[model samples]
Target: MKHLPLFALLGGMISGMAQAEIYKYVDSEGRVTYSNMPIRGAKKLDLGPAQVISSPRRGEGGGNPSSASRSPTPSDFPKVDTSTQKQRDQGRRKILEDEMRSEQQLLDTARKALSEGEQVRTGEERNNYQKYLDRVANLRNEVTLHEKNIQALNKEISNLK
Candidate 1:
């Protein structure tokens, strides 16, 4: 019957829509991969030989392909709120100054502890004295780090002006 050929053609069209052509590739390490998706980490890129599903070449489209695909160009540099930055710097400086004071207090405590520790004639007391010395060293390092941060912020503000 003439309807038989028409039904077979319709079935073929349905099957074409159901099946997807997977891309296959092999990396430099000789690892073969086949996927219906494209994602990062898989180096071998095969969007299939063109002409069937050709890529839009440059000049073929009115706009640059990158302009079309990419997000709007971000500011060349971050827009710094100078006033806000100065405020933040002031807060940081205050915190650092407080930390320096706290470190000085810790140093004083360690010195007193060591002086008291010297009077005690026991290995445990000497060990305790050494531990206090270590704490003082670490606190000094923290004070130094905070000072550096404050100095850096000052330099940045000066440069902004």
Candidate 2:
């Protein structure tokens, strides 16, 4: 009866060993491959004995595989207090608003300059009208640059949470 029990155990062990076979291969590019099913040129890898690790089943305290692969956030990471963050945001908004106002003033002045340049011709411009046109163009570009700056500042302020 004892011999019968030993024979059954041996048979179970043999079946488990057969099911645990793993094959390994290297491709032409030197990348290694591992698989349960044998490939044409794969060699059977003898990994001694399989190690079994028992874990709680999913829905019973064991985390899902996706959660397991994610790294846990560290407890000691720096965090800003809500009030301080709000204050910083307000300060940034104020600075952007001030800059936007300055840009708007500069844009107004540039537009006025462009208008005056278009209306009046200088001594040099009387010889070549292109000179007056070029001055007007430069003034227009300055106005455009300031307008763009104001728009960017407004966008930044609007994006603040």
Candidate 3:
């Protein structure tokens, strides 16, 4: 009958669904094959779902109960270090002073050169020399700006104390 083929087809499907797939592979050394067994010497691995499956959690489904009622708040916070802050402030101030002094010395040398060049006789010579003077003036302004920055940083460090 035609029902015989249908029954056989259903039986085959049921049998296939009932049993999970069995993965087999050989190891690096000469050995026989294995099925559903984890071996230490084998390089390959099987990751079948039922072989290493995890069930759903209790609170996952619709009617599941929750063990934890609510999320937790902060228990405590760490304290800030005030004395180390003062040491950092002092170190920053010293670094600023060193940099400002270096910049000032460089600007002073540039201004001295500009002044000596200006002492030359006037004409096209003085015009070219005035360019050098302008350059030195710009450098002196930059040095002053750096000095101001150093003062501002010093004030910030003092405020932190």
TM-score leader: 2
Model 1 misplacement above 4 A = 1-74, 123-161
TM-scores for all predictions: 0.33, 0.54, 0.33
lDDT of each: 0.62, 0.86, 0.62
- Angstrom error of the Cα, residue 80, model 2: value is 0.5
Q: lDDT tens string, model 1, 98-154?
A: 665665675566556556644454655466877656655665665566556556655
lDDT per residue (tens digit) for residues 1-161 in model 3? 97999999999998775454444566657566855544555444434565665545556552433334333345676555888877877887777677767766766666665566546544654568766666657666665765676577566646543
Q: What number of clashing residue pairs does each candidate have, in the order they appear?
A: 0, 0, 0
lDDT of 2 by residue, 1-161 (tens): 76999999999999777679999999999999998888999999988877997776667656865465445668998889999999999999888888888888998998898888789999999999889888888988998898888889888988888
Order the candidates by TM-score, highest first: 2, 3, 1
For all predictions, the C-alpha RMSD in Å is 18.7, 17.5, 18.8
- In model 3, what lDDT does residue 85 have? 75
Model 1 score (lDDT) = 0.62
Off by over 4 Å in 2: 1-75
